[model samples]
Target: MTVVTLARPDDADALSAFAETAFRHTFGHIYDPADLASFLTGWNPPDRIRAQLADPDWTIALVRGDGGAILGFVKLGPIDFDLPAGQPSEDATELHQLYVDHEAKGSGVAAALMEWGIAWARTRAAILYLSVFTENPRAQAFYRRYGFVDVGRNPFRVGNHIDEDRIWRLDL
Candidate 1:
């Protein structure tokens, strides 16, 4: 079984490296390699991830394989963290990012990360929410398996242009 732990600031480099590799595998085909590289570099660059790692409240949960390899991680925070103007009800948890190494795929790592996040959030309140790209139906379906229901839609800027995102929330 994989054990999930609270990630410390020092883990930023490893996390960023994982994001780079996993991101390339996940989206390189959908976009020009150059575009994907540029996008990923800018978004999850060492500097950026390091800054987030230093945040006082932002949380990152990481899971490691039995041999100690990183399998997956989930970034979560108060709804207000990612959404500047997002005013959720009293009980709302925002999922910022979730990714698992491809080799660890289909091993229930993602579900375990989500479960960790939801349980952690429940300690803070009663609802869990997340926003995912409108184009990624696979992820939408995956979220559904955890009982997350689509509730609304909005456009969020990625790189330059805005893209549609579906909001899903589960009542705790």
Candidate 2:
């Protein structure tokens, strides 16, 4: 069984470690090692995650399994990026990252995190949005199941490489 909880300040280290492992498990094969390393270093650093945990605008929720090990996490927050014209600029929230460990796949962790994120968004914004790599069809399909519709495309940067990512939005 797994339980979901808001990440605490002390969870910074564990969250950082789990995030790196989960990211590598999902996208390691898609990017060059150098690029992947650079992205991980900047994105999952313990200090960065710890700071985020302290930010009121961000919510970092974690899914813990047996022995209280983190199985997955979701980071949701107010929109900080520029949305294309026609996309509502106000009352927008972003599901910045949703990552699950490989072993936790098919165990309902992702679904739980997403459910919490959407519920949280309902109280905070009019719409919830997320960006998934264009090549990740499985993720796109999963988002579609939750009523997220494609709105546009955006450039996602991993280190110095730019990749196209499909933007999906769910109106709450």
Q: Which stretches of candidate 2 lie over 4 Å from their true place?
A: none
> RMSD to native for every prediction?
2.9, 1.2
The per-residue C-alpha lDDT of model 2 at residue 122 equals 88
When summed lDDT is taken over every stretch of 10 residues in candidate 1, the lowest stretch is 80-89
**What would the per-residue lDDT of candidate 2 be over residues 35-139, giving only the tens digit for each residue?**
999988888788888888899888999988878888899999877666777999588899999998888788899999999989988888999988889999989
Model 1: per-residue Cα lDDT over 92-147, one tens digit each: 77887899998888888998898898888878768787888788887888999889
The number of the candidate with the highest lDDT is 2
Query: Which candidate has the top score in TM-score?
Result: 2
Write down the lDDT that model 2 would get: 0.88
Reference-based TM-score of each model: 0.82, 0.95
User: 80 in model 1: Cα distance from truth in Å?
Assistant: 5.9
